[model samples]
Target: MITIAVDAMGGDYGPQITISGALKCLEMVPDLRLILVGDQEQILPLIPHNLSSFVEVVHTDQWVAMDDKPSKALRGLPNSSMKLAAQCVAEGKADALVSAGNTGALMAISRHVLQTLPGIDRPAIMARLPVREGATYMLDLGANVDCQAEHLYQFAVMGTAFAAANGHVVQPKVALLNVGVESIKGNQQVRLASHQIAQCDALNFIGFVEGNELFSGKADVIVCDGFVGNVALKASESVMRLAVDKIQKRLSVWWLKWLGLFLKPILKGLARELDPTYLNGALLVGLNGIVVKSHGASDEQGFSNAIMQAYREVSNKSNDHFEAIMDQIEF
Candidate 1:
């Protein structure tokens, strides 16, 4: 069975939603085992007796709050739910960890406990984005705001490994997000990172990609500093929401309402594809162990998706593949 430790008190709704999500995930993956780490008083009451066989609870009264500083959590809250969850993975009690907690604290605690993989300078947050062809993965979503060319190159390597591990992609095209597609368009950092990626035969660098082409499916892996990636992600999600709202309003008209019946299937598919909740989990790549971070405001469905993402990584033996790829690259 694939075992995962979850921070049962880490999200906006704490055990109310985390427990629900864990139970929902149990229904989806039969061979999965979950260890819920949080206060017994809160987490135990939420779990149903029928599903108790597949879940184990590790009681802890403390948990990092949404506004807690990273440093404080790293040093002060050693027994917090988030920290204990990471410890489960680090100590080999569980194969992975899933949390929808404070992003900064999660990063700090995971890095300190699990540490970075061999040859990796730092860890990065990689999230999936829906594209025209299928889905594309981007890294450094909000981990490191400033990065060097080497760091970008490492992100590309990690991204390439991630795409290939999905078992569908072959030699995924890697690109640097820039102002324009032209080589001379971006700042010195982008140009230098592009050059570095081009030299690595292991990666399939496809030159620079503009913001407009983010969802155009031109590249399977997009690498940028955390600042750019985070902004682009939030902006793209807003645009998707706006588009869906406009379509709903347009269909509310008397004439369009009649036609909406025939277009119901198509609209349903579009809404599913556009919903950010469907792609909520963000993997903290380059770490020695698997740690998937769900959005803090995620509901039951979103948190369940995060758990499943961690399961997939473990089943695919993704960390072994990532280490192999990293070993092949120098600097």
Candidate 2:
């Protein structure tokens, strides 16, 4: 059974959404076991008595608040739910961890507790975004604001390995997120990183990509600093919502209403593809342990999706698998 540690008191709904989602995931994956870390008083009552065999609860007195600063959580609360969940992985009690907690706190405590993988200076948040070719892996989604060219190289290598391991792509094209495809378009950092990546035989670096090509499937791995990546991610999501609303309103017309009904299956497929909850986990890649971050406001479907992601990573020993590939690349 794949063991997954879950911060049950992390998200907005805490035990309500997380514990429910854990139970739902257990029902889906019979070989999966979960360690739900939270306050006993808040979590125990929610779990069904019969599930005590598969689902274990670890009680902690503190929880990292949604607004708690990373430094404060790291310095003040050593035994928070988030910390204990991460500790399970550090101590080998759990194979992977999932949390819908304070993103900064999760990152900070995870780094402090688990440390970074060999030769990695920092961790980057990588998420699979829907694209023409199914999905593209984008990294540094609000993890590191200020990054060096070497950091981008690490993201490139790790992102490439991730695409191959999970996305089932061979020689996944890696690109530097820049103003244009030309080397002259971006700032010094991107241009320098591009040249270095091109020199590294381990990574399949494909020069630069513009923001517009983000979802065009031009590159399987898109590398950028957290500021640009976070903004672009949010903007694309906003645009997706706007486009969906407009399409729905347009289809509601008297003549098109029947056509829309006839294409309901196709529409539902599109909705699933675009649904954020369907692909809710973000990898804290470069950390020593496998850590997945669920959206703080995620519901059962989304939180469970995150847990499933942890399960897959644990089942495949993805972190160790990727590390083998990473060993080939020199940053």
Please name the candidate that would achieve the greatest lDDT relative to the true structure.
1
**Stretches > 4 Å off in candidate 1:** 258-272, 275-280
Tens-place lDDT digits, model 2, residues 195-309? 8889988788888999999889889999999889988887776676676667778889998988767766675566555644346678899988899998888889889999988
Model 1, span 1-331: residue lDDT tens: 9999999999898999889998998999899999999999988888889999999999998899999999999899879999999999999999999999998999999999999877678789998778787778888898889999889988998899878777558898999999998888988888999998999888899999988888788889999999999888887767766776677788989988877667667766665555443455889999989999988888898899889989988999988877776677666
Every candidate's lDDT: 0.87, 0.86
Instruction: Give residue 197's error in model 2 in angstroms.
Output: 1.2
Clashes of 2: 0
